[model samples]
Target: MTPETGRQLRFAVLDMQVIDPPTGGSRQRLLGLFGQLGSATAYVGTWDWRGQSERKQMLTATLQEHLVPLTPAHFDAVEREAAHINGGTVIDVTFHRLAALSPGYVAAARAAAEVADVVIFSHPWCWPLVAPVMRPDQLLVYDAHNVEGLLRLGLLDDGARGTALARDVVRLELELCRAADLILACSAEDVDGFIRLYGIDGTKIRIVPNGAFAAALSPAAAKEREEVRGRLGLDASPLAFFIGSDYGPNGDAARFIADRLAPALPDTRFVIAGAVGQSLAGRALAANVRVTGAIEESAKADWLRAADIAVNPMFAGSGTNVKMLDYFAAGLPVVTTPTGARGLGGAAGAMRIADAPSFGEAVRSLVADAPLRLDMAAAARRAVERQFGWDRISPATGRLLASRAARRGPAPFFSVVVPTYCRPAHLDRLVAHLEQQRCRDFEVLVVDQSPEAWCGAAWKHGFPLRYVRTDTRSAVIARNLGADLAAGAVIAFTDDDCEPHPGWLEAARPAFDEPGVVGLEGLILSDKVGDPEWRSVTNDGFEGIGFMTANLFVQANAFHRLGGFDGDFEEPHFREDTDLGWRLQAIGKVNFSREAWVFHPPHRRTEERESLQARSRFFEKDALLLRKHPGRYPALFRAEAQWTHNPYFREHLLRGAARYGVTVPDELLDLIQ
Candidate 1:
């Protein structure tokens, strides 16, 4: 089907990057798109704007721009200093997820969307910030500068930032495509990537390729160009220029120009321009090469005016190269790799496209034939002016404002309550496992009941967290406290020592959404460490049996209605979860979501010692549980021991005494009988 075209519509471009100064290529793409798009306002999301004004001047003066501010909760100067002292960061959350933690940005995006016909997310990262609150009337456009997931993989040395960042980025990009009403791809390659990588509907995507977005140059005359060259102390040698920002691909290209291309031809003068020069720090370059760390626009124009030829040896990166467009716009005869020519291969007739091994030969041919260089330069200028110009791109994007597709569903928020008492190592392990979860809609509440408070591990995990310290050390009390402070519709319960599965919440969400499912429980796979520490809770998967709060979720309304786990079931924290589960089951349905599981490793790091004293404490708690539910409580244990707490409690106590070859102490004898 033909794309609906020529229908005029207003656009609200939502970008998370600080576009005012614009460091990267994505910002340049956004700026170029926003400048000419009729009746458009770019809402740039900035969470940390401490010294942006002093950094660089902005060009948003020519267009409408509203800054959507969202400062993190207590990421002060002190916290930043603490992070440095801590060796590494406690939390490794992405900026987009961090923005989701801010309700202010969500509200701002929603309010801003009301006035615009279409909301264009400049990159995949911006989608999570606005998708949850997107209005039904507004169209969601994902402007795919790159198939970010694939691009991130090719960036840097495989695992420079580790697998977590790359994994999260890919997951985020997948969700962005599913949620977008329309996706604006930079190349036909990027379009196929979305379809092949995620298998999204190819029809919803449109190619609005990158264009010549550089500023108009001043003083292109021979004397002006020669004077600029003379200022740089460059001789009358033929200049071969390559310009780029400090991205990994650009860095590779810069190094290519300095190492590979220049050493081969000492007679030809080479200049590596822009922030890309910083990558060559401390490295010796070829004598023919001059590295300009970074330059202003006018300085760039001077190099373009004076340069004999342009070259791009880039091997990695996604999307069309904006630097290639800049080279074409400046009327320079260019030589580049096929990887460098990705979407711009249509301009091959006007430029030289070669593979990596043959890139030197291509550049040499252009540098040697002066007449051929003049012809290629004229052709490159004509290509940008006609086919690759912003003027052509604007009309091709009109269909994005006209199209509409079904929006992806928002993930449900859950308050994951962890009743922790000491074993900071266990808490750290749990934090790592929680961060690995595919879902990002949950917040963790670590109700720490350690004798010494853990100096607050709040905001130290990928998820939003609250670390609370209490003088009273009780599992029942911690659960109650977490429930009281919970902002989510569902309050999920898991122990501090347990490692929840990554899909635990994603699997649990559906069960809670069902009608009358006031509370639910999940499978607990007990993992024994060396000696058996406690009851290996590998629940036999029996129906109506494994309602242990080791992995549980209860509807907030029903939880508060039942007064949240009876506090009387205090210390050796035995039957509180069972008591609450039974109580909730009486009021409404308590279910089991089999796939929503957690690993219940033994309390190896904990001080839950096995002794007569500990056994006596357990017996006392068992007596309390019997008193609370005389009929139901006994049914759970042996039929004979179930009648009363004395028989059941006495057996466990005597059995514990037998292990040490001693009878119950005289002082405690009467209590057990």
Candidate 2:
């Protein structure tokens, strides 16, 4: 969350990029989740080398225009880098400056540890050096984006130098899993492999698969076909295309296609795409073979449009193949190696799997059988449009983030309960703020303590607000009463006096996705009256101190389960919110969302303070705490309350008993009362 403004969870991503792609892959993957959750802040760190067009082209092709050129200078300046992408994009780019081999890179990354909530290492190779120095408060999530590859390149191999090196790398990754607060695996198989390989608990691992490209050129986009095919001059020919060029497996496949596949059929022309600036050995310049340079993303569809068949003669590679999805997106019948089809759950039926020699035969077979080719093409189009598109893929990302934020269960609509008194102008302002909010999924339930006439002006505002009237003066009772009428899956309670940011709901909503997070509270601060510099803890402009009820959102079922706020305390008092927070904490986890904040105007009254003191009497008396809730709660209540300096408590409460003219029970007064 912006610390002072109290909106958006800011995350700094550390990775290498050669150029930004026009289409979204990693950028879309991360940003789509950010848009759904609306709290994540991404800081991409890329290299600055102007040379190596191959590296630049791949990065540019993959990232398009979304790439941000970041470097060691950017890393040095970053106060804290939260999340890690590891080496997912390790095509031709090197982590030269950020390598553990270099002390400066390590130091720059280590410096980010000072300011992050979570510090993730994309690979195990860097974790042993990085994790030991990070703040204890910061959570470390290892993006095992490379788990399957790590095993294929590590534990499964049987060599001395290569095996030992892979083993060390695997060991490092396993160590990261052990030390991290969370381990994120990209696939279910990877998750299982990680658990089996590292012997880590299954509960600690999260399955957040990589996202697909965002462009959804439906099979019906004939304009894309005409435009792209016209540019490539392929509309007149029976074009057989094979993408993926430079990687070891792709290079091997390209050579195999040129040397083996093209020779078998001189009547059919083969177009090889993907490599822009490199040449491979064994590439035969036969009349049937044509090696076209990297195709523009816009023209990829056209090539697919003119193609008779798409062949993926991959010899090796361990993870999910992104090209298979691209071929599916282009609506082409694909012929792939087994390695190229890994982790694509249901996409197997959409394409034919063949080895290098079989790949040549499969292409020949497709050319001979028009009906089989047509069926496979239809299946590929349906598979991509239905199951492999970004629209289908992004929801899983949302669910993952939401699960992490809420930490309990699935997401539900939030009922934001605003308890108003005599402040009509403030209520109007709050209402206006609420109306402008980004997440409009929440319902506004305004529980007014005053007469209907006082809220008449607010009633005319025409916002979709549900009004509930109660003569009860106790804010605690009103909040609890509000809970009974709340229809949302989650209940957010904020005071009428506070002015929330437009993104407050946007920021807090994602925390619901976190595992074990049943309750979400944000940093609350006095609105504009405090010292500007000293107000925010980190000066990212967030009021980092309070988690007031005025800015708290709770799951509705959990809220009702805890019975809402206790009304025994005085109206507008301090301990009531803390009491509710304690109760909710007893039932499930309470997450402090740095992003979900509201601006509470500084207002305190002695009557409210005295009433709060009376509530503290109940908390201080161990007997009352024991009787009110079941076992194992009083101790936690004491700890969190003490740790946060519960406003209702005073050191004097521990000593005074007879002064109140009441005989206190020994258990309540004795033992650190």
Candidate that would win on TM-score: 1
Candidate 2 C-alpha lDDT tens digits along 1-673: 3334454433333444322442323333443322333334332333434222222222221121123343444444231221122222221112332354345445645555445544545444445545557766455667665563354463334564334435555655666778876666555456557756777765456544444453655453557666666776654555688776455567777777777878887778888876721455454477777776676775666666677777777766554556677777666777777666665543433566676656767667667777766666776766655445655444433333332433323333877888777778888788888887888777677778786545444555434456766555557646755664555677888888777888898898888887777788776656334432222211123222223577787876455434355432332244456556767776677777667767776543244533435445544333222333435434444444542444544343442221111233454335444
Residue 59 error for model 2, in Å? 14
Output the number of the lDDT-best candidate. Answer: 1
| TM-score, every prediction | 0.54, 0.49
Against the true structure, candidate 1 reaches a TM-score of 0.54
Question: lDDT of model 2 at residue 62?
Answer: 18
Candidate 2: residue 320 Cα off by (Å): 0.8
Q: Which runs in model 1 stand beyond 4 Å of their true positions?
A: 1-8, 21-24, 47-49, 52-62, 69-93, 100-104, 156-161, 218-223, 403-673
lDDT of 1 at 310: 87
| Model 1 residue 74 lDDT score | 25
